[model samples]
Target: MDVSKIHGFNFPCPIRFGAGASKELTDYLKANKLSRPLLVTDGTVAELSFFKEIKNDLQQKGFSVEVFSEMHKNPIKSDVLKGGDAFHETGRDCIIGIGGGVALDVARAIVLRVNHKRDLFDYDDLIGGDKYVTEDVPHFVTIPTTAGTGSEVGRSAIISEDESKKKRILFSPKLMARMVFADPLLTMELPPFITAATGMDALTHNMEAYLAKNFHPMCDGIALEGIALIANSLETATHRPDVESRAKMLLASLMGAVAFQKGLGVVHSLAHPLSSLLDTHHGLANAVNLPYGMQFNYEGFEARFDKMADAFGLSKNNGNRVVDHLFEMNDRLGLPTKLSAIGVEAKHIEELSELAEADFCHPNNPKPVTRADFKNLYEKAL
Candidate 1:
């Protein structure tokens, strides 16, 4: 666990984590005998210096590299389809995801699309479509840029419909990345807003997963630890990032994704609609509405909140304290604590509530979330 030196981990997947882990890409490619790679990333990251360096480094080492960056901030089916096309057209031997959640999701989806020929949404896991995922996928690798969503270690992709903007889960164990190069150096340059938003996103995942209605004790342990890591490091990571803080945030982000196999809850359900309708960043939406969602869940889940309070290092084991601390944390991070500050209005509440009720995450909530409850939460947050 020294952030300055490389450490290898094997849990849900194989991850090479540390300061210079990304430099192993060329050696990995040479050993695996993969000459051509399709690198999937977002538009913003495709232009960054590190991304350019990665691409140039591969080329200089005599490897053929093709890049696919045509994707929305919130990914859709077309994004995966386009990346799949790039993979086939360029005869890519593997798919290497090189940025944040959006980029990693697109890369995982394209890995599925490489061999599965049905309509993209036909593979939606919500509809028992994983049974149709019988074909083998291309070798996949991930190098995460942002410490949010932890999609680098995830086996599922969240893709939305083009016209409806409804999210779909394309999932299978076959979609897991063959390897992950988790370099904290890539995350050091993230601006304050992104660092804060993504850090909150990681915290939300751990909190919601710890409270989700699943019976997984292992996930509960992991979630609480992830929360504690963020509680200690998020502010420093956002305001004055260094090797240790960025590394901890990245580690906590990965732990959040793994812990959330117990599942997410109302906060994600509430946040997804905002990303679909208002084009708000997913992490920012979660950051703003997280406390309200927690407040709604605290009525009968006091014991769970008490555990979370301990994770935050509060002497009192109280649900109310957990809610208040979340609000204060948002303010300290310079993130908006209210939906109104982020352009959410009363007019959008009805539609957002409908979408929230239709969302997949809330079904796993510790308590049931009705459409009426969704409306009420939005109103309270507004």
Candidate 2:
């Protein structure tokens, strides 16, 4: 992949985007005068040759690199504290998050813990907590290895609360990474199933963001374009895994995160509980629930769905056509069409509904979502 022609952009954040952009890490670190860096990643990504190669390159350049890779898929509050201990123990001056959403989120949370004196829950975004995140944290860089979640560029990190078993959003401008290396090459080796699920997650983000009852035209425009990009390249990126397709999906994922600052809807509200309760893959949970969520939201946002259908190139521009297109896309991507297919049962509906109703994302939905509405949506998905 000749990424020499690729360029960097500073759209609210400095991003080095292309196939081989990961190779610029040394230059970025040097330019910022950051040497003692802690690399935060997941255990699986730490085993990859890409991570090993970067570790070796940094070591050869005499940069002391420490790593913390013990975080969970849904990182708990304790994991953030443990990561903070490692960060301080190693005397790391900066943090480089080098994997998917989990690692990036934990990295940001760890940075928060490094400087703040309060407990992690004190800064939860749900309870007017953004003011508590007042300290200037360490310099942070994010390199995403997956094309989902887009936590690399996000200002909030979702960490799980142990006792409640619910995901908590910790939001602050300080959590945003100072730099992001959006290299599609990092996602090339991902399995087709993962690629499909994550691609659908990205699509859901853009679609739901567009449908949310927000007054941001800039975010609306970005969301629509993000959806178009995913519709065009997701299937190819999943099945064939080429550079162009991967690059497009990666870019779309970033756009999804950027646009979703406007808001997300019931899809994320539904998916977060699945992750907290069933330990389901976040992307897969979102993929399974997205169409049902869209269907449930369609009555209030028929014009939005019509626009989305047109974006997907459906001949008929209507809400039903949008739902049909999503079903078709799920089939083509080999994703589960029903919640039952993913081990979700009828018994789980009430609890999932309660959790979904209480979720921060529920209020932003285009259609007002109640506990009863959530139960009905769960039943429909099942």
Candidate 3:
């Protein structure tokens, strides 16, 4: 593929693609001049036999590798600190982030603290609003076990605060992984519901980025293509879980991450708080909030949305059709439609709305959303 033909997209990572490319982990480590590498993953993925294959290979190559599965799902600040302690204790000079978003986030934070002398909160872009003090932390390689989150290419890590229910993002270009290995085989074990939810999350990334009021054509084209791909393949992949469908979903996720570099809007803003507060699955929260944001942004970018609707094969002209299609998609995929259906309540609306409005993604929304607008959306979504 002539990557330049895709307009504004550029990925600096040395990405290896295919079903079994994960077997090349040892070769990649050698190529990158890494010897002792700490493998960071959550308890869930660490328990899988697939991870043991890579672990044993590194051992045979005389590359000291250690496993840390103490990572949390939402990835608390303490988790990163603990991971940092392990990195220091083992004298590991490189990191292999080998799980989902939480593990990836922890790995990113651990690398930063290895050489720098600052509290994790101090480096947070959300709270401290400070630029990350990026030194050469480690040569990091990310291998995503799931086809969601896109933390492999993301330049920020979301860590929960010390005493708060909210999560904060630590940002820097140096936080991006040095290499990413996209192996479709890893996604084969994913359950149908997770596949549906994560695929929808990727779709939301493309949709929100395309709808964002930004001037980046590169992100726009990537988002459009990503959205189209997800619409076409998500259902098939969830039901079938074959190599072809898995490859398409994985590629869609990569494209979604690249697309959202332009910006994301209220869907992410709303979803973040839901994940923090309700402990709902991140992708499911995004799925529930997506339609409301679509309706809200429709008037501001009807033409762009019209183009998207056509691309998604909707016969109608605006976001309403897109919203209807999403509802149907959710139903087919066995996802809950309303917040109430997912155990959220009317009482929680005020607090969630306030926090959501303050979320970083709010300003990038194509339309300005007020507290009332948020409450109304929550009520309607409920």
Candidate 4:
């Protein structure tokens, strides 16, 4: 790796690794001097046996712990407000964000608004105001149950706005979790399709970050390794359902999240609006848009894609092989291959294209995207 090619980058995060690492959560909190904590997670994850063990451990450690599980799949401003109010009412000094991205994002927003002003939209990066984040945001820890989204290590939270009908990004380094616990055991029971979709989502993150116009070798290296790991383990993890595969998948997801701190591209930009308009699962939406984005960026990323092929053990000219592989992987994993297959229609393309072009992530893509480009991509995906 030529270190000279990359410059001006900052990476910050503490990571706890391996299986059964989640058992050390209370010790981590105590080491950081947090005694009162709120466990922020979704209802489905809260019902998992993993959360049961976590709840028992926190209580046994003599910490005052409260649960807040009202966050939605695509969290909204109202959801953040509710979560912040819950944190204030509980008088928690720390937050334990568990489950998937939605829960972690909610936890970040809750901490952001804990003792601050009430207007959640004021804090959104798209709203043209100063960031609401402060160093006083609660001590936070994250444990992700799903092997996608990578919110455990991410510094940004995505939420939907009812009025705008689009997803908004809220970013702050202060919102980063103090500790990120990657425990593969918690992901063992995930359904095959969910595993596949989330794995593809992680792959998309790595691809987009690598293709983004950013000067960060560390993030680039991380993205390459993340892509390789997903290539090596996604299929096995989806079909075998073993601890080792699960562990690799979880690590890959975290790596993807860490890498994308550089930026994302058209896939995520296009997927976000499609998800909002069609009620598509976030990961699945990314999966459907992956190939289209790859084709769009093909000319610009030929050399990079070839390098990625080398890293993933593909032939020299097989630069775009991942696209075909992703389609096959989606079919094997029982996910939708096309937008139309998933119920997205031509009628929504005009609106979806305009919103996708307006997306913040669109500018970071390796290839410049115009409204016509977005419309074509949407039509191609369908």
Q: Which candidate is the best by lDDT?
A: 1
Error of 4 at 32 (Å): 2.9
Q: Mind giving the per-residue lDDT tens digits that candidate 1 earns over 1-382?
A: 5888899989899999999999999999999999999999999999999999999999999999999999998999988888899999989999999999999999999999999999999999999999999999999999999988999999999999998899999999999998999999999999999999999999999999999998999999999999999998999999988989999999999999999999999999999999999989999999999999999899988888989998999865665799899999999999999899999999999999999999999999999999999999999999
Q: In model 2, where is the ten-residue run with the lowest total lDDT? A: 1-10
Question: What TM-score does structure 3 among the candidates reach?
Answer: 0.94
Q: Clashes in model 2: which pairs?
A: none
| CA lDDT, every model vs. true structure | 0.94, 0.89, 0.82, 0.83
Q: Please identify model 4 stretches exceeding 4 Å from their true place.
A: 1-11, 127-132
User: Pairs clashing in candidate 1?
Assistant: none
Leading candidate by TM-score: 1
For model 2, the superposed segments whose C-alpha errors exceed 4 Å read: 1-4
lDDT of 2: 0.89
lDDT by residue for model 3 over 166-279, one digit each (tens)? 787788788788878878788888889889888889889999989887789988888888887788788888997787777777778888888887889988988888877888
Which candidate would rank higher by TM-score, 3 or 4?
3
Query: For candidate 2, lDDT tens digit of each residue in 183-252?
Result: 9989999999999999998998899889888888898988888888898899999999898889888988
| Candidate 1 regions with alpha-carbon error over 4 angstroms | none
Report the poorest 10 consecutive residues by lDDT, candidate 1.
311-320
